[model samples]
Target: MVALRNLLTALFLPVKLCLFVFHHRVGRVRAARAAGDRGAISIELALAVIVLVGIAVAVLAVVMRLANTVKGKVPTDPVVTAAP
Candidate 1:
């Protein structure tokens, strides 16, 4: 259980760090746009959203496929074994 917890923490840390960085970057871009820079903040936001949505959709597809595969492998009924 300790090992499992450590593994989960290790895996989750990077994802959290990435999200934090993305948020920070977006905030900075927004601040720059607010400061009257003739920048492509809209384009950057659109691209980021598109990429995130694409990743989400891809992950959903993979999860659905895995769920279906596992469901297909499960027995529909309980098995009976004779007592020794």
Candidate 2:
């Protein structure tokens, strides 16, 4: 029972330590955010907008390529009518 307890403690000690550090770091970030840290928010928003625009551009390129491929395979010449 003692050995099992020791093993469990060894496994969980690092996890607990990490959680403690993360909790404190998050608290400090929250405090800073509450203290009027607007620049980070703006930067994050800009990055998000840039990412969305990039995705839109990529999708547009793919659609254009598909349109061109389909257009190439289509028969564009006019059909002739038979004489009566």
Best by lDDT: 1
For residues 1-84, what per-residue lDDT tens digits would candidate 2 score against the true structure?
A: 999999999989967965785576567567768998867756755675687679769979999999999898678756889999
Q: Where does candidate 1 stray beyond 4 Å?
A: 14-18, 76-84
Tens-place lDDT per residue, model 1, 8-72, is 99989959976996888779787977887635776777787788789879989999999998898
The lDDT for every candidate, in the order shown, is 0.82, 0.77
Residue 60's lDDT in candidate 2: 95
lDDT of 2 at 16: 90
Where is the poorest 10-residue window by lDDT in model 2?
40-49
lDDT of 2: 0.77
